[model samples]
Target: MASNIIHFEKDIEFSKKVVLNTSKKFPDPKFIFSETSWKLDQFQNLKTKLNFVKHKLNDFILEEWHEHTSKMNPSGLVVNHVRKHIHPDFLTQAWCKFYEIMCNSSLVSQKSLLTGNMCSVHLCEAPGAFISALNHFMALNHQSIKFDWLAMTLNPYHESNGHPDTVSDDRLIFSTIDKWEFGPDYTGDIFQPRYHEHLYETISKKFDNGASLVTADGSIDCSDDPGEQENIVMSLHNYEMMVALNIIQNGGSFVLKMFTIFECNTICRIYLLCCLFQSVEIQKPATSKSGNSEVYVVCKGYMGRSLATPYIQMFFKSKNHDNALLPLSQIPNNFIDELYNCSSYFCDLQIKTIEKNIITWNNKNESYKEINEIQRIICQEYVNRYKLKPIRWDQDVISSSNWSRARNNKRKINISYSEKLRRRDLCLQEEAVLLYQEIVNFSNSKTNECHEILWGRCDQVSLNISNVKYCLGKPVIQVRSSKFCNDSLLQYRIKIINKFPCIDSLSNSESRILYFKTKLNYSKNGINICDLTDTYAKNRNNNVILQYSCLFNILETLQQKSEDFLLIGYPLYTQIAVACFFVIASMFDTFAIIKPDRNFGHAFAFFGFKNLENWLNILSEVLKYILPRNDSYTRSKLALVSWLPIQQLVKQRSHLDIVLLNNLCIAYEVEPILLSFIQS
Candidate 1:
């Protein structure tokens, strides 16, 4: 293949000189750059030189790659131009990298690696781009091979995974959630040792031996400490390697993303990789920006696991110890020289390109004819070399039978509200089971009075009413009812919240209740509820818009008060109702859902307003449909609830898993009562 690739092989004589024997003490890394070693000094000096230009030229250099160089690479531009659906840029980068590696190396063509049935595992693979890329490759080349794959990453939706730490994009995972293994804790954090064990066991069960291929594109944000990028990501690099070594099949191929090879930890890891695989090749794909230090290590033809067991033990055991793997003095002198040369080569290339980009940025009016010519040649070469064809795997991926199953599981697992009543045969969760027992006990009582149960729990502390500075004077809780709900039941629930006519009995409630009615027009057929089975319901969309407008208006008046909120009864059987519920729930720090009646869907109580401004953009999209339009172009804004993708809906939904579960528990309990009432 016509690509920039550097290959390394195991030197038998050099390997004999080093200690390959087993030892109880793990091979740890501890090395400092010394003046005596010119190779180390040279590598460090080049890095220092690169850092000098980085501050001012970083953005210019990146723009140069994105706007010019990467587009010149044929494979990089192919996917974007030919694929029907849009995807993350990393998807195309992964495809280009893998395509070059597969073509240049003996990964795909080798019979030993391309078995009839193959399995692969991707670590730190959120929003799964590499998996999709591989799927496309297999469909094009190895169509007869049965490919089964698994992936894991920091769970984006898990509350424990905070911002800047997890991949918040769920565009791909929303459809392929089942293929991911998020460990026993469901955090998908590979840094945790337990996750490694769980992933190993899972791979073992499916492949028996292990996965035929393992890929890890894990990295940490080192922008804060750019000089120590290698050091900052050293521990993660080790963990990824250990997991891959443990889960990969004998004669399998392993691909890992890494940075510069200057640090002792990095050099040691690369040397260890060279010893385990028949060949280790480092390549910075044409798609990757020249301004960055990112590169992929493609290791192929793994020696059997038994042979690597001792090294694996050392790798894991080194975690707690401060010992050195083969100290700086023990690694082969020839290998050290090769490492220094490789580091300097890439560093020099980066520095030169950065300088050129700096000039280009200053010259703002630079001609693009050269770039266009380069792009034409590369595009032609790529099409001819790979037999390129239009690829559209985004729809093909989500349209599988598993999509429906994953959607169903998402609802049942307390991720969202269920449009339909809970089925008796449906498996009940631990929380649901306990709530069911509570409901049965309540049903056996003789009292017929209306009641409100606090089934949902939110740990968020209520705002201190005295310290508040919002426009609203006191804490106010407004109760609202939709046309679909029973007005008598709604009034009774409001009375319960207000503790009406019992104020002299020494209660401590200070909040005042206000009642509002939704202006929904009821028809003979009632509200047309649409479930996930139906993508769109055209009849009752206007009612949905009216409800959205009412809620949006209510939200517009909200302030950051401690106890100012609305207790609303709305049916969640329609997509718009569910979307609007999420919008309201997300704006409050503390929220709960009440099942005021057995036949009702859900009644929500949101408290302590927060993040209201952030959601107003989406809510405002509904108003374009409600307002009068003057031009044809202005009517393009349809109801976001009906037009938005399921993934977008999932991403916008609040972290109200408990609230969903609480409502579902009531759904399960009320099923029998509603059934008996109907029979009578």
Candidate 2:
């Protein structure tokens, strides 16, 4: 390619001017890059070091430059003038002031540290605030402590000079965190970012004196003694260059400012610190809104490993540190689906409760089968609440250079309704049959016929004998009531905390079910001298003679993690029919939503769990209820099968049964799904 020459002349003048200005401001606030000093253990001393008026003028100049560069950006998103008032000089002054703040004050506290002071590193998704806060603190007065901030000052003077339009718009201004070279450009801008030179020097001094921020790497693991560290604060959200978790210590308290990470992601993080910290407390800051970037803190873990090691390292394959330097690559091809299909992305997680809060079931239905169904319903409700639009599958979220050109010439896909209905009807058939088989299996086991009969099910599945479209109507479902009934301990309690039948509940049903027993004395006559079994008789509510074989807690898990109503893509009629038989093996229900999240989890964990006996049974019941599956109860085991990945729904359309269940709920006072189910 031939090169153009008009760019050189313009750039030369700007570069020269920037150098001249840098030299003039260089002496305004004399900076110390030495190893030893008095009243110098913190950045606060650096603030008092600068000349006020001279430093102010220099700060003003930098802001002016930043404002000019923003206007020159390719994507025309500039700060709103009405509220932000971001001018070039204003931005520069902001950066300098931020640096002065970083220099003079401590964003971290001694209470936040132990024998070693820990400096937690955070990235700001909105970089401006990061710098602004630093400036406000630094340009003003000293706090009790000062932190080393690596805030950036964009090189605005380079604007209009006609440089190559490569990525590198963001530049690091002042901070002692790192060298501040260009890493991945997360969102806003990640072009040619320049960093400060004296950071390494300042930080090294902190280390030699053993007063550095936190412990450095594995050799200094202290997750067990968090009360030792100072007050912890997490304010940044953009830079992924450093291991944010490593910046703090074990048992250290925290003020985390989280925005988009999912509840699961948070759980995973805490799980990693399980060993290092005795207890972990996670909370959202009051200053945050449900719609804003969310925040939460991981009470510091002090040992070699925390309680959640497995969960923390559960995700993400190793990405090389060297490769981390590339400017955020087109948001990558894989991130879009994860935003909603699996976990939270950068978007604010808005937890929506109905205008009228969700109802709490009053009736107590403690039957074994019904309680399991309630858990299924809760999970479904969550999915519906957070689910996003379907996305197309691709290696890269952004169209490749070649893909961009080809996409414009590509064709669209289409399908029909009659075909969709036929498919769903077949699914309903399979659902019915699977339910009957489980009843037969439990009856045939000879494990106390009363046990089989006492565990009542199908107590109330509202039928729609009318001209309705889908659903068995609303089943006043035993699952909804079983979880809260008084017989919970006798029925499902396992551990002290698991008594509520929830993995995280206060007490488990399994652990409490076997508390009562009658001691027997052996006579010389042996069996001939045995006494009558009347002593074993008691209130069913007072004693639960649980048959462990009959209850593997599988049903309980399904109640928690499964979805009774599955949504699928249109044209997936074949998949729907197969879903009927899968009921027994899947222990999952089928509702017909056809979306990405359902499809992927279904495809991935289809048979991945250690115990599917209960899942298979519940799934069999769901298929029997939803499909005409009851007729073929003795047939093959793949009744609930669906080769179609739920991920495919990211491309297709459908609905989940829980959402339908919710619709049935809102209409419970009016039309009741149970009325429709039984009547039909």
Task: Please name the candidate that would achieve the greatest lDDT relative to the true structure.
Answer: 1
Q: Which window of 10 residues has the lowest lDDT sum in candidate 1?
A: 5-14
Residues 530-612, candidate 1: write the lDDT tens digits: 12111111222234444444544444544323343544434443234445555555566656544343333224565555554
TM per candidate: 0.56, 0.23
Any idea what lDDT model 2 has? 0.24
- Local error of candidate 1 at residue 487 (angstroms): 38
Best-matching candidate per TM-score: 1
TM-score quality measure for candidate 1: 0.56
**Global lDDT scores for all candidate models:** 0.51, 0.24
Candidate 1: segments with Cα more than 4 A from true spot: 1-39, 58-79, 84-91, 109-114, 319-325, 391-395, 399-512, 515-680
Tens-digit per-residue lDDT, 1-680, candidate 2: 11122233222211210000000111110111111112212222212222121122222233432333232221112122211432222133223223322332233444433332333333332223343333333323332334343322222111111112211222222111132222211111222121111222333343333112221111111122211111111111212212333333334322233333332222222233332343333332211222222334333334322322322232122232222111222222233222233222222122221110111112223322332333233223322322211222231112222221111211121223233334345543243333223323432342231110111112122211121112211111012111011121111111111211111212222222111100111122211111111211121111112111112222333444432321111111122222222232233222222111110111111212234454345344443433222322223111222222222211222222222222222221112112222234
